[model samples]
Target: MDAATAWLVAAVSLLAAVVGPFAAGHALLTKREPQVATAWIAVCLIFPAGGALLYYLFGINRVYTRARKLVAEERLPPSLAPHPTSSSHGIGPEYAEQIRISDAVTGRPLEPGNRIQVLSNGEEAYPVMLEAIEGARETVMLSTYIFETNTSGRQFIDALSAAHRRGVDVRVLIDGVGEYYTWPRPSTLLRRAGVPVARFLPPRLIPPQLSINLRNHRKILVVDGQRAFTGGMNLGDSHLLQSQRSHRVADVHFLFDGPLAQQMEAVFAEDWAFTTGDERTPPKRATPHDSGALCRTITDGPNEDLDRLVMTLIGALSAAREEIWLVTPYFLPMRPLITSLEAAALRGVEVKILLPERNNLPFVHWATRHILGELLHWGVHLYYQPPPFAHTKLFVVDRRYAQVGSANMDPRSLRLNFELNAEIYNRPIAEQLALDCELIRARSRQLSSAELGERHPAERLRDALCWLASPYL
Candidate 1:
């Protein structure tokens, strides 16, 4: 009622009104996703100060600025540049448009003469990785999202330490958040053993440079620049066999030999440079193998290359004429990806998606089930694989193109976390992957429209609530 109190209230109201629209305008300008932008704008308008602070802390595009600086300052060899005539590679005229799109997005060419060998789980991949590390003549580069100090992790640590002791240039990078599995992280163990190790974006609260959300989820290993391994397997006991454990995790990993390996190495080198601030000379290009496998490496994250992987997937789906088979542990596809799949299905393309029966992350499982009804309604067959929780990330299109790597279908892998995948244009590899998919499908239970319709009301409500959080899941 007093004039002074009225003046104070009026000033505060005026300030909030001015600040709210400014923040909302900033969100509208920066956010690419219409839904995200609208949500942020509404929040900024309704909550003002609190919304502005939250946006300042979490909504800004910090990664893109840092990534641009890193890329600009990092000196890379000319050999890492895209090949000029790679467009003419034997991807067929039908896939030419997709290839061009991929090339423009990734700045990498379709490399030919690469040989790929699929490795199933840690049982198959670990021995080969250890052997390659032991035989390393010059350098060994290893990076993974999770590097737990468990049985398999210890073995890897030993191999890497031994390699370092033998004077091989060994560098290891592990995700900071993932390294907290044990008291002394695997990176610490490697560092104690004199192996050079760096943690990607360790937790920091003061300067606030690191992020727990934007993780490095890529799993890559290159030995001597000649052989490389990558896929869904991380360094942990969970991935390896333990007789006492009844349920285990299954995944698909791959070994690459030839020119494609160099591209993989280039990715590792770039990450290493970004983390350690060390200038790296490009690794020698591996000789092309006799095999005619044409492959290209695709890396995506929330940085400058945001949505590249999802765009690549959409392009591949649009190009598919016969079939699309995808296997992932988690499934929370973006709107564009879902639309692409629906369009492909409408065009008579067989769209089959296989997911784990039970996921380690319960929230992700619930969120994934939320989208099944729409997919099933659109003629996109959904299959739930039986347990031992398959964590394989794979995609095969038209029995002529295949992709395998560390990315899941969720927002975390596709948009938030750093991820890598290899696209193969070889039919033999694609056929083998297709056969593997079939074997998995034989054990999976397909979800029909009736099955989804029969879900309990409470379960449906839970799924809807979980789906609401899919952007963060």
Candidate 2:
């Protein structure tokens, strides 16, 4: 070999030797999942120069780092409001530990006197939400993952614009990534309509902000600091199954009237402040009476608030005595969660999980199939609700404790996305949610070990591959 070519080869080998191990070591030290770490480590070692660049660009936990910076600068507001009137009465001693778990994780008090109404779909949720916007006397703070520019989304845009024109304190926050679901994005339409709107962490070229993993997946609509709406539903026509012929989704949303609404307002305020750098002054809310239910909101994301909802879920699952009913669109449970489910079922608790028979994301559903045998072996019953794909996310324990909101059972919702969930300590509400699940369960088909085992080898291989990539999904 010539002298110049030999020098080039030596330089390349030296660069690989230095960069590859560094990236692999970083993944080993920082990644939470062993499989994820191993995958990155293998990539770094196998491809050396290119793999290290990939790890530097995509493998690092830049989301958490950026979030930590926001917190350090006091840009991200605290999850809970101040001077909360926590209700300790009427709740049984059985839920004391559960209460403690949430309290410790969120530091948010249980807001009493919350009157929650279940809205079946956009048909029910949208009208009430629009009515609340129309009737807003003070403020209308709305945030959603997707704000499509379809027929249903336009109604919301018009309502928010009308509310703004009427001198109401109106603010709309749409997820940066989800805004691209349609052309003539809602932000643009809202801007043209004289409504104040902001996109959460939108992709930008000037500032070079392009990361899309840590998205704002929260769905919140707080009106007048007295009424709020939140759930798995988004502001889009797909949720209007009554009118749509295909790609329709079935979901549930809840309207909160009482102190819980104020708490939700606080959550929106924090998210808005973080997104737009505008500190919103929350309106003084009247002291609400102890209505029918007690609830607390749990806000989680890829920041310091990470793992809070998952911890709350594990705590609730561990505390389940009689029954546990969980429903979600996605079904990729982490190892600890799967272990908790197994333990719950072994303790004589009836553990039932409901998932969609058809999924909007087929890869997620395929990945979910890979873990069915493990859960089934532990006496956990799993069911698939028939299509029009179910988009509801719910968790109920013993018909006394329940949770509902935008966070799904997958890693994207629990670990990466900014999700909002509420823990309800009302027997009636829990029973109602459980009953809803029961009705769906009746129409659903339960999965058996034999069914999973009978899958073709190639199909199982595909599912296994998808499962291995669940962290990214």
TM-score of 1: 0.91
Tell me which residue pairs clash in candidate 2: 113-291
In order of appearance, the predictions have TM-scores of 0.91, 0.92
Candidate 2 residues 281-329, lDDT tens each?
A: 7556635665668888988887654588988999999989899999999
Residue 236 lDDT in candidate 2: 84
lDDT of 1 by residue, 1-473 (tens): 99999999999888888877888999898787888899889988899877876776567556666676446243322243335756666456866766767776777777888888899888899999999999998999999988878788899999999999999999998988888866567877888999999988888788776466778899999988878899999877787654456657899899988888888888888788888988678889788877669888998886644477987899899999999999999999888999999999999999999999888898888877788889888899999998888899999999888889999998878877888999888889999999999999998998788877888999888989998878777
